[model samples]
Target: MSTEKKTKINGINFRTDIVCYNKIGKPILLIECKSQNIKINIKTFDQLINYQSSLNANYMVITNGNKTICFNIKNNKINLIKKIPLYREV
Candidate 1:
């Protein structure tokens, strides 16, 4: 991540928890890490969803060390997925 780019998402300035980029420096995975005590809910998912318009990451993930959730974007629509694709699959 750079200080210049990706600093503002959806017009709101905030730092992302974790972002995994590919060789070309395109954001492939956007993750939001939370404490185990924090419930994984719509609000948590929304946080990552809010980044889509700006980041355009292919996958969105939220994990709290105990449980993990993953979603994939296709045709500009978001869908919950059972497994995340490997780098080659992307």
Candidate 2:
């Protein structure tokens, strides 16, 4: 993450979290990091989605130590993208 970039998220902000932005400085994606010891669940999923919507980001990602899932937003709908979101795709 860029130290100069402002990363004020609606919910709790994780320092390790990587939130990407567009050329205009609009938020484009949020990548959430999960602990390896804790199992990912629905509550965490909802929280990530809410944060994404609040930020008006085009994509959101949730990741544990071993795996990652990307949610792509389009037409006001969220669809899971099997692969990581590319900055150029936005």
Candidate 3:
């Protein structure tokens, strides 16, 4: 995991853990990964949502080794996509 200073509508702060992005700059994607040994549940989803909200990212993803859930925020509504959604699709 890598940490980076990010700015959001709320404020600026350091995000301690996040999956690395393919590119560096402008818009970013926040990925939350879970280990196979751990069980995924609503709490984890809530945490991901909070982080996504704080980061103000256009796209967000939560995944275990087997399953993945993606969200796209547009027009102030969150749309859950079947796969990792792109910014253009948002």
lDDT of each: 0.79, 0.73, 0.66
Worst 10 residues of 2 by lDDT: 1-10
Q: Go through the candidates in order and give the clash count of each.
A: 0, 0, 0
Tens-digit lDDT track of model 1 for 1-85: 3322445865779777877788899989887888999999889877778876678999988888899988889998888998767
- Could you give candidate 2's per-residue lDDT for residues 1-90 as a string of tens digits? 332233345555534266777988887888888888766689878767766766788888888877787888889888988887667878
Estimated TM-score per prediction? 0.83, 0.78, 0.65
Model 2 reaches what TM-score against the true structure? 0.78
Which stretch of 10 consecutive residues in model 1 shows the poorest summed lDDT?
1-10
In candidate 3, stretches whose alpha carbon ends up further than 4 angstroms from where it belongs are: 1-16, 19-24, 86-90
Q: Is candidate 2 or candidate 3 better by TM-score?
A: 2
Give the C-alpha miss distance for residue 5 in model 2, angstroms. Answer: 8.8
Superposed model 2: Cα runs more than 4 Å off: 1-16
Report the poorest 10 consecutive residues by lDDT, candidate 3: 13-22
Clashes of 3: 0
Per-residue lDDT tens digits of candidate 3, residues 1-90? 245445353464535246434355534567877887766689988777777766566777788888878777888887887887554554
